[model samples]
Target chain A: SQQGEEDPQALSIQEGENATMNCSYKTSINNLQWYRQNSGRGLVHLILIRSNEREKHSGRLRVTLDTSKKSSSLLITASRAADTASYFCATDRRNTGGFKTIFGAGTRLFVKA
Target chain B: DVKVTQSSRYLVKRTGEKVFLECVQDMDHENMFWYRQDPGLGLRLIYFSYDVKMKEKGDIPEGYSVSREKKERFSLILESASTNQTSMYLCASSFQTGVSTEAFFGQGTRLTVV
Candidate 1:
């Protein structure tokens, strides 16, 4: 089952613009990770934020988690044409050592060169 | 590099034929999963294995079964293929949640059942 739902099913932006996408989850999660998928390829792991972490950053990618609202947002600063791909948010559900990760529908981002 | 490898990049099979999709992870992660992705439905879990010889049914497991005889190898079997089973299949592996939350994925296998 899909635990996360991504907002803005699709987004388009110029090369230098910042792109932001939000994800909402139904249940408590131990951590949330973001992945990027280029056309006709496998997904690449981007970043991960834990439940206790309100915010985290890696390079130009920033992730914010709100346990109170059961939501999270990913911000890509100074986007590039190469950032054109589908982004998916995954929730690592905190269960009895189950280690199950549920993925969202994903948001497609297109960057204009 | 850590990796998950799928047996094929594409496959064409006939309806009512049995099919097997194989995935092997060199990382030796404790958890492995099989998911199917459609045009817009996103990735839906078909099954998962936490340890060798152990399996759990996911949201959509009625038409599929999984085998995990070895820790590094996990296979998805379609007892009887149907046209509705045509889709892209993805395999992923991750360490125990406490160790790492990120999962590494394999290049998906595009299955076409006619």
Candidate 2:
């Protein structure tokens, strides 16, 4: 079963706009991470925010986590055509004796030029 | 830099044929994973290996099996390929650094079954 579910299955915005993507999960997690995929290729890790931290920033990317609500959001400050891709949120949780990471279906963002 | 390499970037096979997908990570990570990505289904875990000669089933493990004879290599095998099994296969590895350490992925293999 999938642990995280991303909101706004798809989003479209003009260049230079800010894009926000939300993810909600069902269970507790040690951390939440976001990734980007171009077309159908492999994933690129963006940011990882631990449960102890509520917010983190890397360059123009800002991520916020609300463990109480089991939700997280990713904010792209300045969008560009190059930013167009599929974004996914993943939750890392303890399972059995090890850890398992579950990824959300993802949000397709299109930054029009 | 850690590198996870998949044997093939694209593959084609006939239905009912045996298929093998190989992955190797040079970072000496303890955990390795195999995931299949589809159009709307996102990435689904097929199998995971925490150590050499150990493996575990993921959510969708019906048509796939895995082998981890060495710590740096993980192989995903399809006993008999089917049309539905064709998808983008990704390999990843992560160290047991702490809570929620990052995972690095390979270039991915796109398999097409006809």
Candidate 3:
């Protein structure tokens, strides 16, 4: 089963605009991480936010987590054509004796140049 | 730098044939994973191993099996290849540094089962 689900299956905006993607999960998670994938390529880790953290930022990326609502959002400021890619949010949950990371469906973001 | 390398970048196999997709990580990470990416289904975990000779089934384990004889290597096997099994296969490795560490992924192998 997919533990996390991202809203807005697809999004398109101008190069200078900021893009926001939201992810909602069902169960409690120890941490949430966002990843980026270009077309026909593997995923790359972007940023991670622990459950105890409410927000985090790295470069142009900003992530916010709300445990009470089981949701997380990724905001990309000053989007560029190079930022055109698919974004996914993953939840790291403790299972059995180890941790299992599950990813969401993902949001396809297209930054028009 | 952490490097996870998949055996092949592109593969073509016939139906009913046994297929093996190999993955190797140079970081000596304890955890390795195999995931399949589809058009709309994102990346779905197929199998993962936390230690040598230890394997666990992921959400979509049907039609797929895995082998981890060495700590730095993980192999995903398809008993009998089918057209539906053709997709992008990704290999990743991560160390349990703290609560949950980030994973490093390979370029991915695009497999086509005819």
Candidate 4:
């Protein structure tokens, strides 16, 4: 089953604008991660935020997690036209006895230069 | 750098034929997974192996089986291919650190069943 569901099935913005994508999960998660996929390629890991961590940042990517609300958001600052791709949020369910990563349907971001 | 390599970037097979998709990881990770990505389905886990010779089913494991005889290699087998099974297959590997770690994915295999 898909644990995470990303909001805004699609988003389009100017290259200099910031893009935000939100994801909501069904159950408690050990950690939430964001990935980016370009066209027909595989996904590339972006950032991961643990449940105990309210916010985390890497480069221009900032991820915020709200355990109580069961949602997380990814914000890309000063987006570029090269950032046009699909973004996915994944959740690792807590205490499943095994490691299983569930992914969401994903949000397609189109950046216009 | 951790690298996961899928055997093929594209494959074409006939319906009812047995198909095997091979994946190899160079990082010696303990966990390997198979997922299928469709148009609107995102990604659905098919199977995962935590250790050599041990396997577990994921959300969608009906027409698929897995083999992990070696630490670096994992294979996904389709008993009988069908047109419905045509999708992008992704293989990933991650460390078994008791906590969920980052996963490295291959380029994916675009399988077409006709």
Strongest candidate by lDDT:
4
Q: For each predicted model, how many residue pairs clash, with residues at least 3 apart or on different chains? A: 0, 0, 0, 0
lDDT of 3 by residue, B6-104 (tens): 999999999999999999999989888899999889889999888899888899999999999999999999999999999999999898655667988
Task: Write the residue-wise lDDT of candidate 4 on B24-100 in tens digits.
Answer: 99998999999999987799999988899998889999999999999999999999999999999999999988878
lDDT of 1 at A111: 97
- Write the residue-wise lDDT of candidate 1 on B3-54 in tens digits: 8999999999999999999999999799999999887777888988889998
Candidate 2: residue pairs that collide: none
TM-score of chain A of each: 0.95, 0.97, 0.97, 0.96
How would you encode candidate 2's per-residue C-alpha lDDT over B41-82 as one tens digit per residue?
A: 888888888889888888999989999999999999999999
lDDT by candidate, in order shown: 0.91, 0.92, 0.92, 0.93
* Model no. 3, DockQ: 0.69
Give each candidate's fraction of reference contacts reproduced: 0.51, 0.51, 0.58, 0.67
Candidate 4, residues A1-113, lDDT tens digits: the string is 79999989999999999999999999988889999999899999999899899999999899999999999999999999999999999988543446688899999999999
Chain B structural similarity as TM-score, candidate 2:
0.97
- Docking category of candidate 2: medium
Candidate 4 ranges beyond 4 A from true positions: A94-97
Considering lDDT, where higher is better, how would the candidates rank from best to worst? 4, 3, 2, 1
For every prediction, compared with the true complex, DockQ reads: 0.61, 0.68, 0.69, 0.73
| Error at B9, model 1, angstroms | 0.4
Shift in Å, residue B110, candidate 2:
0.6
Off by over 4 Å in 1: A94-97, B97-100
Stronger candidate by DockQ (2 vs 4): 4
Candidate 1 C-alpha RMSD relative to the actual structure: 1.3
**Per-residue lDDT over A1-113 for candidate 2, one digit per residue giving the tens place of the 0 to 100 score:** 89899989999999999999999999888889999999967898999999889999999999999999999999998899999999999997675537877788999999999
